[model samples]
Target chain A: MSTHARPRIGEQHCQECLVSIGPERIREEFPTLWTKVHGKPLVYLDNAATTQKPRSVIEALTRYYTEENSNVHRGVHLLSQVATQAYESGRTKVRQFVNAAHDREIIFTRGTTEGINLVAQTYGRRALRAGDEVLISAMEHHSNIVPWQMICEEKGAALKVIPMNDAGELLLEEYRRLLTDRTKLVAVTHVSNALGTVNPIQDVIALAHGRGIPVLVDGAQAVSHMPVDVRELDCDFYAFSGHKLFGPTGIGILYGKAYLLEAMPPYQGGGDMISAVTFEKTIYNTLPYKFEAGTPHIAGVIGLAAAIEYVERVGRNQIAAYEADLLAYGTEILTAVPGLRLIGTARDKAGVLSFVLDGIHAHDVGTILDLEGVAVRAGHHCAMPVMKRFGLPATARASLAFYNTRADLDALAKGLHKVREVFA
Target chain B: MSDLRELYQQVILDHYKRPRNFKKLDGATRQAEGNNPLCGDQITVYLHMDGDLIRDISFEGAGCAISQSAASLMTTVLKGKTKAEAGALFEKFHEMVTGGENAVDPMELGKLAVFCGVKEFPVRVKCASLPWHTMRAALEGQNGSVSTE
Candidate 1:
């Protein structure tokens, strides 16, 4: 009889665990066993949906409510002064995070949805004329598409869509052909939430600028994954959600050029966003305040600043490198599954893997995976045009973040095998 | 290992795999297309009626298991029934799928009883109800471009 040697426990470990193995080690080392004392450690593969809040961000929220809890820009007490300073400091941090030129150019709103709506109502309704064209890509989320449609309908302007290939990459040739003298604005996503394709925004912005057309890049999915320099890209408008970037919900930033913002009308009429309010007429406040209507999410803004600081401390480049490595590994393992077809395979991609099995519904696959405690997003992912172009009803998408491990990929692969078995 | 067994019960899977009257009629009176954009599920329902009675009913499209099965079961049940009866049956099925307390007519529902399991999954309820909604739109004499968000 041949005897096989038994390996010792904890002999092999991940490099990331070796580097940052303080409390996180205790969390990951015995996930199931530790759930008795600590709560269940959720294997969150739904980063594309929303990210898990880190300890620093949670602490920041608690600290702000405990220490500097007061309304900003209204009161005249010591606590109010500290609160106002903290709020301004949060704005400055946002300006630096995206490398914006001026702090006044950043406007805080409810989220990316509200930001897009603000641009549509203010800039789009005012500038676009009859027969003017507003260009958007086929892979846009409903938030990016519906706002433009609403404004175009009211302004009597035409809405044109840039076609995308099967790989989910925007057809640059078709995009160039669509750009005409009547093209007023081109709105595109910086990164696709469904396909994970990172669009080449610099080239897209330059192309739009050549035609004297402004561009709005939806950075809701891209800001947390990669470094975004608004000045370097020279996009006229950029919007992102704080919750998607490891911060709290109900807060987002819209970065716009100072000249265009000044040229546009105010989005809403309110108390704080007014220079003077008379019975006959009202004068709007300066640059960003004209767009911000009411009281904002103060705790959310402070938490977002802390999230940005955490990202900077960990280094965006290092995080991107680790994510790239994980994507490569995940692709290799997922492709090995029999009768599995990946939906989007663009060369320039993020850490998203969307696929469909030969004989199973995406919902069935999702249900089976959920039983194994591995969460993933299924269905069109709010991109119906992309699904129509690809001849698919729905797809299962597995999006990865920097905190994901190779073990997570293995678990996903194992769950996929069970899906195949169920459908075989 | 059959998808019909795991997701759908035996009756619904059988109806989906070999659907009854699953073809376009020579002269269809009422036709409508229903879409569920959230899942990219689309179906075009055709009804050939004589007076108030449904002579033949059919559907043609590609969708998920729940949708296809629901379409198949709906066409089978409505083929020989009157338009009023079909509309009443639609209400019953809708009630059952949406978890309402209204009593379901089991004979009218037939194989569609398997789809009652979908009520537990809120997202799949739209898939199962697409065919009924499309039929309602066609009977109301509307143009065939109905969407369930």
Candidate 2:
């Protein structure tokens, strides 16, 4: 309700300080020289999709490829041994990052899509029976929804969706009503990608557990934006991508309770997944590696470890606070535009702001913003069910991260004005 | 204003505000529903055919300006054309959208030429071509349901 405060202009400080952040300092501190060379000051607000790589993550990637490049978990050569140590150490770091109960529970995956598919193929194939139900929310991204659909189709399991209210908050009463004896698993996003609604995941998990239903929290959107401790939440399974969390692509983390992970079938079959293989007989390895069959993304895993370390140094609490403030700032400035409608207004929300201007198509808005050197995602955001629920075709989404500033929102505001002028 | 004018030509906005042949054809002989699931754009193309000629054409749907206007323009152009001619027009329009050379002159396309700018926006080309694709499907005797999910 406070009047929009003008952000401090042209300040420089260490990554620790709030008051001394400047463009030049950020460019010098981060490895964004390639972006800077293009004669554009990029204002990236699509963090819900993926975060920009910092200098440390890029350097770590380079260091792994140049200095420690070798196949891991095999051979007695020194390079192979160092690579194996770094890769395994990266696994330990991931376990700590999400506070998984054991390192054995952290299975390296090819980002969130593969992580969920691994669960669906392994656990869903074994545990789910015909007439049993997998309850997912209406706000799930395509990655979360389609995998469950495939599993349900194969197993004759019914997929039930938990609906949301107009404010983009999940209808708790409806969810409770939908949870019957047939409910086998409840897979939900920790944060809604389209609506920015930070779901009450702890309560959701507790309720499902009370009913003897396991829950998988898709932390693809939540992990980077907030502090996530899987042990405290007591979720049976959690999945998130490294790219979304400022790490390299082709790497993700799937956290499951050690017992459940050990019980599930191997997702893929190849070299590292087996203790020994013969023409007639084969023995499977232990947890984590049972699901990870092929040679993993070693450099990507090391880079993810570096990214997690960077996040810890910055502190999740500080990052969350900064992002929250930016979200509020962005929301105020954006909603001030005449005839501008903010689509998602959940009481508990993340930094995503999906909205529509009365007379402008979201694509047009996105195109104009791109020309102005501001990037935001526009469309159903892979959550077509959410758009259908609100009777909207598409909405422009400006999702923030720790790196975004109030000036970015100001540029967005200016861009919206241009949209209005063009449409008018 | 002039730069924005390039993207949204006056004719395009005019068709969007008051689309031609923008009505349902009850008991229509050929009908198809086209959907761009990415944006939730839906259009139902209705054609009342007399032998091989499209005696009447109309559409009813909800979508962004580009899609709605494209549908309106498609209906207007195909209303009196034969099924074969309409199919050829569809091919030409498809080529124009996907950046292939087409024989249809820009000026001859009338208000439909307003979509020429859509070629530049690779993402929105789907929006501008949804109705034409649906109409082609209907003329080919396919059921009235197609979705770009």
TM-score each candidate.
0.85, 0.91
Give the per-residue lDDT digits (tens) of candidate 2, residues A1-424. 1122532212111245332343344434354433631245777778887888877788888888899899998879999999999999999999999988799999999999999999999999998899999999989999999999999999999999999989999998899999999999999999999999999999999999999899999999998888899999999999999999889999999999998888898988898999999999879999878888989999999999988886776567777887788888888998899989999899988989999988677877887777666789989898888888998889999998777778889988988897776667
CAPRI band for model 2:
acceptable
Worst 10 residues of 1 chain A by lDDT: A1-10
DockQ of every candidate structure: 0.36, 0.47
Off by over 4 Å in 2: A1-24, A27-40, B1-3, B101-105, B108-110
Positional deviation of residue B11's Cα in model 2 after best superposition, in angstroms: 1.4
A-chain TM-score per prediction?
0.91, 0.94
| lDDT per residue (tens digit) for residues A70-183 in model 1 | 988888999888888888899999999999999899999889989899999899988899999899998999899999999999889999999988888999989999999999
* Clash number for candidate 1: 0
